[model samples]
Target chain A: MTGGLVYLLYVLFAVGGIALYLAMPRTQGAHAKAGLVIGGGAVAGLLALCAQVYMAPHGSNIFYYIFAGVALLAAGRVVTHPNPTYSAVYFALVVLSVAVLLVMQRAEFLAVALVIIYAGAILVTYAFVIMLAQQSGGGSSADQRAREPMLAIIASFVVMGTIAGRVSDLRELPNSPVEVQATADVMDVPLADTPVKDAGNTLSVGRTMFNQYVVVVQLAGLLLLVAMVGAIAVSRKRIPADEHGPPPPPPGEIGRTVPPF
Target chain B: MLLAFTQLGFSSILALVILGIILGMVAYSIYFERKIAGWVQDRYGPNRVGLPTLVGDLLPEKYGKFHFWGLGQPIADGLKFFLKEDIIPSHVDKPLFLIAPCVSLIVALIGFVVIPWGGQVAIFGQVFNVQVANPDIGLLYILGVGSMGVYGVVLGGWASNNKYSVYGAVRATAQMLSYEIPMGVAIMCVVLTCGQVRLEEIMASQVAGWNVWNLFYHPVAFIILWITMFAETNRTPFDLAECEQELVGGFHTEYSAMKFAMFFLAEYAHMITGCAFLAVLFCGGWDPIPFVRIPLFRPEDTGIIAMLAKMAVLFGKVAFFMFMYMWVRWTVPRFRFDQLMRVAWKGLIPASLGVLAVAIAGLYLGLHRTLWFTLPGNVAVVLVSLWVMSRAKDPVSGREANLPPLTRSPELGVQA
Candidate 1:
C-alpha cells in the first residue's frame, strides 16, 4: 500500500477505536452521542478511502454505498449497544444490509440464504434468549460494561490493518499473462460476472458445490453434526445443584460443577 | 399515469394492484371473521353498521336503504381506527413500540411478491408474469419473509413492558421457531417432488402433466403445512401466544389506536399470504380445476380474459383457505402451551420428515410425480405416524417429564 493510504488507514482506525471505547457502556457513564458521531465519520472516511482505491475501476453504485453504510453502522451498534435485545435486532439489520450487498454482486442464492439463516433463524434465537434472560428494562450490568475494550480494539484493528494492507498490495500487482494463467489454474473457471440465465446463480452454485467441493461440504455438515452432539451432551448432564438445590450457582461460578456424563 | 405505468413495467402495476387487493381483503377478512364467529355462536355480528348517515342522505332512497350485507363495516372500522385516540403507553420502549407494527405489516405484505397469482398474461402483444418478482428462490423467499414475521411479535411484546405481553412474545418466539421446521420440511417435500424452487415452474409442473396437484402426491405434507400455517400465523388452535383467557390481548395488549389496527391488519395479511403460498405450492396456482385443465384455464392460454379467469381461480382458492381459517378458529379450541409444543415437536415435525423422506425416495426411484408411488407413500406415512402415536406410552397433554421432580418438602411431604 501507498504511504499516504497507510497513514489514512492508521488515522481512521485510531479514531474508530477511540470512538468504540467511548461508546461502549461503562459503570459510571458513556459519551455515546459523541462516540457515535466520531465513529460514523471514521467509518465513512474508511469506506471512501476503500472506494477510491479499490472500487475506482467499477463505477460507483449508489446501492452498494448505501447498503455498505448500513451494514457498518448496524454492526457498530451491535457491538456498542448496551441493551442486548437491541444489539440482536441491530445484528439483524446488519445481516439484511449484507444480504443486499450480496445481491448487488449477483449472488442471489447466497443473499437469500444469508437472510434466511442469519437474519431469520439465528437472530430470532438470539432475540429469544436476550428477551427472556434480560428481565430489566435497560440491560444487565454485564451488558452495561465493556470488558478490556482497549486490548480488543487494538488486537482487532491490527489484524484488520494487516489484511487490508495485504489485499491492497495484491490488487496493485501487474496483470501479467502468467498471473492470469495461475488464477485460471487455481479456480478452474475464471472469475467473471457471468450474466445470470434461466436456472440462475443457484444452479451454478449448487453444481459447483456438489461437484467440486463435495468433500468440503460434507466435512462442514459433519462438523455441524459434531457440534450438535457436543451441545446435546453438555445440556444432558444433570448437575446435583440444578435438580435439588435452591438455585444453580450464578453465571460465572457454573464452571465449578462437573459433568457426570 | 399510463405512460408512468408503461415505464415502470407490468410487474410494478401488478404490485400496486395486488397491494390494494390485499389491503381490501385484510379489512374484509376481519369483518368475515366476526361474522363467522357470530354464525358459529348463533348471534348477529356487525350487520347494523351500514352506510354512514351523511352518505346515505345524499343517495336516492332505494340505494340508500341498501345495507349491502354489512359491506360498509370494514370501511367504518377503518375510519374508527383512524379517528381513535393513538395511545402509546408511557412505560414502554418508544422507538421499538412504534417500529414493531410496521415491521409486522411490511413483512406480511412483501411475501406475496413471489406468489404467481395468475401465471403468464398477454397484454398489448407482450407476455408478462402476474407476479411482481419471479426470483429463482421464490419458495425460499416466502419462507424467509414468513420467518421474519416473528420479530414484530417479539419486539412488540418486549416493548410493551407488561408481563402478559412478555409471556405472549416468548410463546410466539418459541412457537414460530418450532413450527418453521415442519413448514420448511413440508415445502422441501414439494420442491423435491417438482424438482424446482421457482413457484411458476412448480405450478407448471402440476399443470403440464396429468394436471394433478402436488397435494395429490404428498397429502401428508399438505396436512402438515396446513397445521403449521395456523401456528405460523398465530391462529387457533395454535395461538397460545394471544389466548385471551391467559394473556390479556397478548403481545399487542398495550398497543392502542392505529398501532393495534396495524397488528390486526398484519395478522389478516399473514393469513392471506399463507393461503396464497399454500395455493401456489400444493394446489394448481391459477388453474380452476386440478385434475382437468379446462379450455381457457390451461397454462398455454395467455389471453387477457384467461388471465383474469386464472386470477379469479387463485383468489377463489385463497378465499376458501381464508374461510377455513375462520372455520377452524371458531370450531377448534385453543391448545395449551405445552400441547402446542407437543403438536409441533412430536406430531408435525416427525410427520413432515417422513413426507420428505418419501419424496426423496420417490425422486430416487424416478417415480416422484407418479400417483402410484407418491400417493401410497403419503398414505403409508400417515398410517405409520398414527400407529406410532397409538403406541406411545406418555400422555400427550401434561407436565413434561423432562422437568426436574419437585424438591423434597418436609412440611408438604413431597419428595424429589
Candidate 2:
C-alpha cells in the first residue's frame, strides 16, 4: 500500500511540476514548454525514485539510489518556472540532490563529479547566458531564413538515430558471464585477503581503475585531452571583413604584420 | 534468446519502461516551466493550444473571442521543431556540431541503466537485478558516462562558428573544470563516510536510517555540494551560453529546426539526470516507502511492489528539486561572471576543502563507522551557506558595482 501511496505522490508531483512548466512564458513556440515538461517530469520521476530509500533504508532498495540520484539532479531549470533564473535555481537543486544522494551511495567520486561538472560548470554557464540575454534583442528573429536546407539536417538526425539505435542495440554483445563470477570471486575471498572490502568497502572504479582498469581510464583521459586540444585549435580564427562574419580589424593593421610582402 | 539478451535479465524490460516514463516526464517539464513563468510573471502561458479551434469562436477577443491557449501546445511545439527548418550554418564545423546534442542526449539517457529503480524482482524462481546493467564497477561507470556530456557542450559551442559560441564554450569549460575540484572534495567526504562505492552496498548500508541524513554528518560537505551543483548544471546566473544581450544564442545561436531542439532536449535530460543524482545522494534513494506490515510486502520482499514504491519516492524527490530549480531562477538574479568565478575559486572550492578536511578528521575518528557526531558543524555550514546565498550578488551586475555601459561590451558586462 505504501508503494501505492508513493505512486500517488509521484503522480501528484509529476502533475504539479508539469503544471508549473505549463504555466511559464514563451513567444516563439512549444519546444520550450515541451522541453520543460520532459525535463521537469524526468526530475520528478527521479526524485520519486530516491524517496523510496528514505521510506525504508533497511529494505534492500539502496542500489537504486546511485543511478536515481545521478539522474534526479540533472534537471536544472527545465522544471519549476520558465524564467532562466528560476531554472538556474532548479538546476542547483538538481545538483544538490545528486550530490547528497551520491554521498549516501558512497560513490564519492561520482557524486562530486555531478556537482562539479553539472552544477558548478554547466549551471554557471547557463546563468551567464540567462542573465546576459538582451531584454530587447530579437533571439528568435532568424525563423524567417528562407529556402532552408532540409536533406542534410534529416540525414544528420538519421545518422544520430542509427548510432544511438546501435548503441542501444548492443545488448547482443552479451555481458560476460564472468561479471557475475567476478562478484562471486570478491565475495569468496577471505576477508583478510580481500583488499577492497578491507579498504572501506569502497569498490570504486578509481581503485580498480588504478589497478586493473588503469589503462582504460588513462586511455579515456587521453582521448578527452586530444579532443580538447583539437577543439581549441579548430575554434580559433581571425574574424574576416565583409565575408559574412564578425567585423574584421581596421585596414592598416593587416600590413603591419612582419612586412611579409 | 531474447530473454537472455537483456541487460539484467527480466529487469531490463522494467528499466526501459521506467526510463521511458522518466523521459516523457522530462518533455512535460519543459512545458510547465514556460507556463509557470507566464503565470508568475503575470502573462498567460500556452493556454492557446487548449483552445477550441473548430468553432474558432473561443479565440481571445484580442483575436476576437475568449480563448484557452491550446492544451496541445506542447505537442504542437514538439512537432514544429521536428518539421521546422533544420539548418547548419555554412561556417560551422559540421561533424562535431551535428554530433554534439545527440551525444549529450544519449549520454543523459544512458545514465539510467544502473539505477536500482525497483531494487530486485523475482522471476522464474530466480531473483534478478532490477537494473539495466549493474556492472560491478557501477558508480564509477556513472561518473565516466556522465561527464561525457561536457564534451558535447564544449564541442557544440565551439562548432557553432560564432564568437559568442566560442566564448560560451571557453567559459563553459572553465566553469565546469574549475568547479570540479571542490565537487571532488565534497564527494570525498561522502566516500570517507560510507567506505564503499557500490551503489547497492551504499543503499544497503543506509538501511539503518536514511544514512542518518548525510547533511547532519558532514555539514561542510553538504554546503560544498549545494554550491558546486549550481555551477555544474549551467543554469541561472551562470547561463552565459545564450545571453542574447551579448552571445546571441551562445553555442546554439546558429542552429535551426530540430537540431536546436536537440540542444534544448539534451539540456532537459541533463536537468533530470542531475535531479535524480541529488535525490539518490542526499535524500536517500527509493527508501521513502512508509511502514509496511503485510507478509508479502515486507521490506525484504524486494518485489515489484517495493520497486514501484521506491520509484515513487525517488521520483517525488527528483521532482521537488526540479521545481526548486524554477522557483530559484525566478527568485535569484544571475551572478556577475567574476562573482561566479569567485564562488568557484574562493567560495565553493574552499568550503569543499573544509568539507574534505572534516571528512578526513571524522574518518580518522571513525565518524562513518560510528556516527551521530558533527551535527553542530552541519548546522553551522547550513547557516553559512544560507547566509552566503542571501548575500551573494546578482550576476547581471553585482550589488556592489556601478552598472557598466552596454556598448563597451566586454561580452559579459551587464549594461545598466
TM-score of chain B of each: 0.92, 0.82
Where does model 1 exceed 4 Å of error?
A1-3, A55-58, A137-140, A169-197, A233-261, B1-8, B52-66, B397-416
Over B1-416, each residue of candidate 1 has an lDDT whose tens digit, in order, gives 35644424898889999999999899899999999999999998887666666554566877655565676899999999999999998999898999999999999999999999887887777788888998878998998899999999999999998899999999999999999999999999999988888898998998996899998999999999999999999999988888899899999999988999999999999999999999989988888777885999888899989989999999999999999999999999999888888888899999999999999999999999899999999989999999999998874433233333334545555444
True contacts kept of each: 0.44, 0.04
Q: Is the docking of candidate 1 incorrect, acceptable, medium or high quality?
A: acceptable
TM-scores for every predicted model: 0.88, 0.58
TM-score of chain B of 2: 0.82
Q: Pick the candidate with the highest TM-score.
A: 1
Q: What is the C-alpha lDDT of each candidate?
A: 0.85, 0.60
Indicate the TM-score of model 1.
0.88
